[model samples]
Target: MKKTESISFQDFMNESYKKVKRRSRPYRTFSFVPFSPFAMLDPTILTIGGIVLGVVLIERFLERLGVLDIVDKISSVMRFLFPLTFFGAIIYFLVTF
Candidate 1:
């Protein structure tokens, strides 16, 4: 009769997994200002626009998961609303200031 040895899950994984090698190059940091034509936009308008964008994104995700429908109509509205709201915010800020 022959005896067999069983390997534990942790031991099997350790043996099968390969460690990634670290890069030898030194890290460098760079800084630059992002182009923001809306930098002067009103805070309130920006906040509202952000909220709308967030809702649209969440709804789209739900639609993908089959948890919700009506995204087609919502997306159509959002297509027009998104740029309008944000750009309106910037315009309003510029005009008011």
Candidate 2:
């Protein structure tokens, strides 16, 4: 008498495992930190760098909106409210967390 071929649990799992791997092979490194203090410098340097970056970003945004020349006027007004914004953020974080 001839013996019939049998499918074991291990064989079934191996085939399914290969299909899962193939399907998920496209997504590799998901979490990424492009900018971090550890990669760059001390607090003082970071603070100054952040200020410069902020100025550049604001300038770019204003230029895009054709308001680049109004930055100085905007800054004078925004300087006062900057503290309020910080205080509000702190209060929000404390209340939520």
Candidate 3:
């Protein structure tokens, strides 16, 4: 049986760099699509936008989960605030009456 050895990281990096160098050379002409000035026309831009949107969505999900986790804490803290709120309401009622 014959066994093959894996290429070293330096050799892999050299080949990858060569491929990137070839692809990165500029061509003679570049065509552009016409679109609304403010709108992004690149698919990569849309993908980036989608990623940002996903991050925001995940952040909101985490925020809601945190709020759910802290609901009992909120109620305990509101015990003190409620008295002040009630006092204000009673004073308002008396002044209005």
Top-scoring candidate (lDDT): 1
How displaced is residue 34 in candidate 2, in Å?
A: 28
Ten consecutive residues with minimal summed lDDT in candidate 3?
33-42
lDDT value for model 1: 0.74
**Tens digit of lDDT per residue, candidate 2, span 1-97?**
9987667789787775344333545655654654444543545445655765686588668868888568767677667856666576546544543
How many clashes in each structure?
Answer: 0, 0, 0
- Taken over the whole model, the C-alpha lDDT of each candidate is 0.74, 0.62, 0.57
Q: In candidate 2, which residue pairs get closer than 3 Å at backbone N, Cα or C atoms, i.e. clash?
A: none
The residue-by-residue lDDT of candidate 1 on 27-86, one tens digit each, is: 887757543566646577668877997978888797988865577777777889888887
* Stretches > 4 Å off in candidate 1: 1-42
**Order of models, best TM-score first:** 1, 2, 3
Question: Which has the higher TM-score value, candidate number 1 or candidate number 2?
Answer: 1
| Candidate 2 regions with alpha-carbon error over 4 angstroms | 1-56, 60-69
